[model samples]
Target: MTELPGTYESYWMETGTGPAYPALEGETEVDVAVVGAGVAGICAAWELARAGRRVALVEADRVAAGVTGYTTAKLSAQHGPLYAKLRGSLGAEGARRYARSQQEAVDHVGRVAAELGIDCELERVPAHVYAESADAVDRLREEAEAAREAGLAASFVRETGLPFPVAGAVRVEDQAQFHPRKYLLGLVADLVARGGAVYERTRIVSLHEGEPCRLTAEDGAVVVARDVVVATHYPVFDRALLFSRLEPHRELVVAAVLPAARDPRGMYLTPERNTRSVRTAPYGGDERLLVVTGEKFRPGEGGPGGVGERYERLAAWTLEHFPDARITHRWAAQDNASTDGVPFVGRFHPGSRHVYVATGFGGWGMSNGVMAGRLLGDLITGGESPWASLYDPRRLHAHEVPSLLKAQGAVLKHFAGDRLRPSHADDVAEIAPGTGALVRVGGRRCAVYRDEDGGTHAVSARCTHLGCLVRFNDAERAWECPCHGSRFAVDGSVLQGPAVHPLEPRTLPDEGPSGKEGSV
Candidate 1:
């Protein structure tokens, strides 16, 4: 398998590595304290600082080291398969509002990049969402119409620069793309220059809320602020039922050295369920990197081999299609998928107006992240933001029930099946070679696999997240959580999250020190 692209080498090397920003040292007061120093937090700090508001941004790790560092970084108003879904779920008015909000975000990014003179390779290019199957054409038409109604410059295209057979595609013109890390760093530098402080290595343990919100950091430092923005991908409040409202999906990405003949100009995406997207980044003069992403699945469930298979699949797909391209980088990023298929970007909980949260960006984090920051900044500064109502977190739309029920049903099936299934190891002698089976081990269920060469491996069937029983998803070849969509490899490695840690490898009686059990 190819080396994953998400490691420090693949990310920090491309963009110059950043130092760990200092943690919150002691009690400090600020106009706004932003949690999670990702694009959202950094952007929020930048906007707040520009407005002459004192801001403090805190990150558990280094800035942009979380999902933001792993993002594919496409800045486009054209979200995949979203317009039609939004129309159905949010109605015509809601759908239009959603589109407008996204467009406003794109424009905001452009304006910021221009004003800051940030050399993040900001370019206005069209984005295409193509349909792989013939049936998807109908959906594309519906999406194009919805986007137009939503006051977007969208149209349908029959042919694209992509080297695949597409039924039809929706194109959102003048959407933008950039180096997310560069853009973020530039904004962060500006914010710091303006007296806005960014504290890294500061893990927020808990939030003390009331008239004023105080965030207690792991180092025992407390931050007193008038308002707080929880942009930690998933809010850390009350273990967040918001996580249940949205499933976590893991997606693979391949950043390949582009061939001389191919210059990927516009952003491209497939409308298929687990489809791929292609875009290009100009490394320098006469040098470019092509990024391909897709192979999405819920965490801990894509079969026996964790996320390693996705890299292999993407490598093969890239080589077969773009043979001249050299596969230099590969990685995976986890995204929060909302049950209603829309992001929640507003006040946290009902009346907790002082605390705001931005979760469930789906796969469009680039656009939505910036949007959330601007919207939240406006909320804090008492400025008028047109996009606020569409992304309201408190509203519960009725249309999301069907999709939510489908995911919940899968979770229920896994929970039920895990209880009834027998361990595959107990009847190992009768099992066929080159296959895996569910088995009982010490009264608990486990996954036991026999290799083609007759080697055996065993792992626990319980998912790391919430302890929901995992089921083998044959299509993806991983153990999938029917509950929140965590996937693990047959060897018990993580394929996705909200399971941040990988599965614990089982110890074998015959193994030595190297073969001992392993955990996160």
Candidate 2:
């Protein structure tokens, strides 16, 4: 096995410990309840509180500690090769709305950071989507034109700050990047100061939508509000059948330290090599942190060596491109892609009156998340937003049918086909230490992980969100459901959701020579 560099953690998370809020202790009432304290939830809560609405922000974990913490933090509207595709699917006006919303999101982040005096390392930089092959240059040019038509200052150029040459690129100015955690934590502090409530480690188990929506926490605490925003990344409460419309993808991020002189000076992305995105952040006095992200795949779909191989590939690519880089931090981030090109950012379902959701940001959540905050706030406050119709969760275009069908097809295969597939190990003895595998114990399927200390933990193989079997992700050391992107720790605790419940605990038939008996 090839050794990969960097500590297995997010660079953002390692930097500082943001302020922590207490979990929901007992029942509470507010005007609105915002679930999941990522960028979307925090921004929404702050927006509502600033508008004199009583709001409560509830998070399953810490604020900005989920996908937001793991992101590359590029607050750019230059989503790779998207304007042209949007023009085709949504026509000219709809594409303009998207561009306008995204650009506003970029400016909103910088404006908020400055207004509130939040030192989040916000830096104004140009963003680029470059094409390496001649065949893709025309598409890049088309995207540049489409973006310009959509009211952006976009231009096609043959030059970039990248070390390697590119055939052509679509460059957009005045975009920015910042430390997501720092920015979010600042908003959270302001939200709290404004008399809005913030709760951490408060997992909402169920939501009862009504005259006053009631959200029940795992510990029996409740939050009553007139409106609810399900921003739990993948929407834990899937009353709208959003799982069918959203496809989950996981991407690997590798960061390394390089001399400040070697910084790329801007964010760059390419569609080639699965997908390559590059940006830099201030590290120390004379060094910058180069963050590279790529290798997008379904949650549990990495072939051969599994996610470990994916990380290796990204690391190798990084080293090849920047020889002076010294690996420092490595992690992964997951996002949901909507069937339609646009995100679903409005009502949770057609029947629900007060229940709303913000999800399916694809990989551009930094900007889309802020966009969701502003839009969701407008909807709850009964104010009109120009981009509301474009992001409506209930809107379904005819062009989305094919993508929806394909996404659902993959889910169906994993739900049924994985059941018939063979387990990773026939018996506990065959499993290795510090690894997990599916094993048949007493004729029942089980997810078993053997700790490095030679103790084994066992849980049912079935995912709580759906009946699909869970597969071990060796690289991340978790059980991931390929169907809907639910992740669980070795002890069966729900790590990422759509699944509010933990995996069912199971008992192993017997202990193997190298493993001691343990229970989840």
Best by TM-score: 2
Report how far residue 366 has shifted in candidate 2, in Å: 0.7
The TM-score values for the models, in the order shown, are 0.83, 0.99
Worst lDDT run of 10 residues, candidate 1, spans 511-520
For residues 1-520, what per-residue lDDT tens digits would candidate 1 score against the true structure?
Answer: 3344333234423674655577789898998999888777787778888899999999876788777888888998888867877777678888887888888889988888888888887878899989778887888898888888877899988888776668999988989888888888888888988999999877786888777889997668999998998888866564445765777777878887875458757899984646788888876666578888888876645645645666667667877777778777766677887888888887888878698889889889988999888888888899998778777887776777787787677667666765765553475444344456666655666666555555666777677767777665432346666667665776787544445455666543433332323121
Give candidate 1's whole-model lDDT.
0.75
Q: With candidate 2 superimposed using the best TM-score fit, by how many Å does residue 275's alpha carbon deviate from the native?
A: 0.7
In model 2, pairs of residues that clash are none
Q: How far out, in Å, is residue 128 in model 1? A: 0.4
Q: After superposition, how far is residue 276 of candidate 1 from its true place, in Å?
A: 1.0
lDDT (Cα, tens digit) per residue for candidate 2, span 404-479: 9999999999898988889989888888887899998888899999898888899999999977999999888999
Cα lDDT of model 2 overall?
0.92
Model 1: residue 439 alpha-carbon error in angstroms: 11
